[model samples]
Target: MFKKLLLVVFIAAISCTKNDGFQPNGDVLSIIPLEKCENGFAGEYPCNDYDLLDYISLEEIGGIGTKGNDCWGWTDPLDNKEYALMGTNKGITFIDITNPTEVVILGTLATRTVNSSWRDVKVHNTVAYVVSEAADHGMQIFNLEKLRNVTNPPVVFESDYDYTGFGSAHNIVINKTKDYVYPVGTTRSGTYKGGPLFINIEDPANPIDEGGFINYSHDAQVVTYNGPDTEHQGKEILIGSNEVEVVIVDITDKSNPIKLSAISYSNVEYTHQGWFTEDFKYFILGDELDELRKGLNTRTIVFDFTDLDNPVHHFDYSGSSAAVDHNGYVKGNTYYLANYTAGVRMLDISNIENKTITEVGYFDTYPDNDMAAFNGVWNVYPYFPSGNIIVSDINSGFFVIRKSGS
Candidate 1:
């Protein structure tokens, strides 16, 4: 009778454990906690199962390059091959990511100035424009085509053109449709006043300085879309993240640009960076210090850009992790975010009109809690043709991943 009782208890314990949940290697899979829903906004659900893939190691990639603060992927329009451009404190590293399983580091171009923690890259035509915050660092232009026939291992190459005048730049954005490259947060002491430096890169090798919109800017995005500011139809507009508020400028005429207006939401922390939807209907803004200042976890503000001059607060979404958002981009209806410590999260914003965002899928490359600190994923490039995502981690280096089922 005692033996029978022991068997029953053991069976019951196993059943209970099976019903509780599956914990693989001590990592739990479920939606993260969320703040109480407010203002009729349904909070985002925690990600179910996020696969953390650490495919490439920095030590394996020639050992000359370190993990960077930002990354951008460019596809060779001629051959449809994909190349990854990763920004490092020392320089920009290029990799051929055609086979994510075996990423190849083609080459690297060291910084023009002393090494610094920040670097940004943008591609136009067949050339890449790299900028960094190092002292006296100007934009370094490189012909990406050099990666086509690289037979040797990773080698450093001299820049094709060094546009020097403005020293350190915090970020670089390209208006591909207009053939203009906007370099924001530039300074040499106070001549340009660190706004957005506009350069006409119609000719990659020779970039002409086309003036800029000055104000104190940290990051910006230039677009020629028909949204909010209709009076400026078919005109180029610059949406900038100033230290205090988000600024909109009419940069159609680079020589005589006009500051249209500025917008600010409730929790006005540092207005860091933002992106517009593919349809150009809504503008998503990120506050760098909101998590620290207001104690709100991962707060992302959305603005209705239908009326450019008078932007309306659409809604706000908070995530489970405490990590602060650095840079984000909207491709189609999906928003790919670089949450510093939480890693790269992909959100489906199809319901942005209803002020709702659901965390469809995520890959936690950082494997740490998402706090408002600069320790993990800095930027992610999800534009690769194969749907492969390239992420740059401040500490872990570059990673190339695709959906597990895909």
Candidate 2:
């Protein structure tokens, strides 16, 4: 999914030993003091309105040498315990963050294939499906319920099931309402040409291939439509972030999908990732290389999807820092963003209709510099009901933070 493959390749070659100082283990490090942003610094890192509850280094979760990539969160419905499903070069790490201060690294599910810098995890019905760019890394399905009984820490777990329909995928999109999973960024020559591969995961373990779209998609968000567009209400839709454009596909009927629309914007560098607002009225996108290519601060583009067929660019939001934006998720009126090098930034989107978005809070895990680079927070999971934000850092591992007074 990286547009500058050679840039990442060069960085990977020279940065593989970035974690040489640390050692690998499943031990929980000491908790970070509850400190608020004071004069732009939260204790040692830069922050605003947010406080860090805990921080775990890569060595504590999996080991040294390996690095973190993408992350997602799961709250066990039965006990209401929150867990962070973090991705590392090793595999998916299950961390018990119910007690943020005493966070525990329960265990890790080894990658089915080899190690790759890119990996993504998404959960549906107590199961998590993970995919990586590693060759032949196919999606690894794990019963998240297994984390409940992780008494012995640091154990190596195996995937409960593995789907080999496609060799490698950059990301996995889940439409929980329809019990379907779409694996995007697959092999370009596959049946779908790296587009959305529809898989029925109603049977979490046994995924049946429904169909897929042939247009290559780098990342996508699939949901049962119920937005401002009344005509397409209740239909299953896929909003894809193709390299050059944002594609809207109606996947209500998997057998016969429809390409509703495809749109691009100015100064396009790479259509990397995006998410729909809670109401599904606006789609926010982040171009992976635009900050570097355009020499602009962190830029976010919003699209008005009231009429999916004739969607228009609503506005562009530029952050104060020049960090590269990765993945972002919206909850209610807040947009939690994983800003590479700039760390995780929380923006208030309540005034989005007025073309206004204000940064409310942030925790800079990577305080080195907020330049346009891919060496910091990879992604953030803000959907956790506990109000605890899970941030996966490319260098520092994982962090759990909350609003200062929340």
Candidate 1, residue 37: Cα displacement in angstroms equals 30
Model 2 lDDT at residue 335: 91
Q: Which 10 consecutive residues of model 1 have the lowest summed lDDT?
A: 1-10
What digit string (tens of lDDT, one per residue) describes model 2 on residues 1-406? 0011111111222332322111112122233335556788866789988877777888887877879999999877776678899999989999998766557898889888889998999999899999999999888999999988887897889998889989999999998787888889999888788998989988877889898999999999999999989989999999999999999999999999999998999999999999999899999999999999889999999999989999999999999999999999999999999999999989999999889999988899998889888899998888766567889999988888877765
Model 1: colliding residue pairs: 31-46, 32-46, 228-306, 228-307, 228-308, 229-308, 322-370, 322-371, 323-370, 323-371
Candidate 2 deviates by what RMSD?
Answer: 10.2
RMSD (Å) per prediction: 11.5, 10.2
Tell me the TM-score of model 2. 0.91
What are the models' TM-scores? 0.85, 0.91
Stretches of candidate 1 off by over 4 Å are: 1-54, 61-67
Give the number of colliding residue pairs in candidate 1. Answer: 10
Off by over 4 Å in 2: 1-35
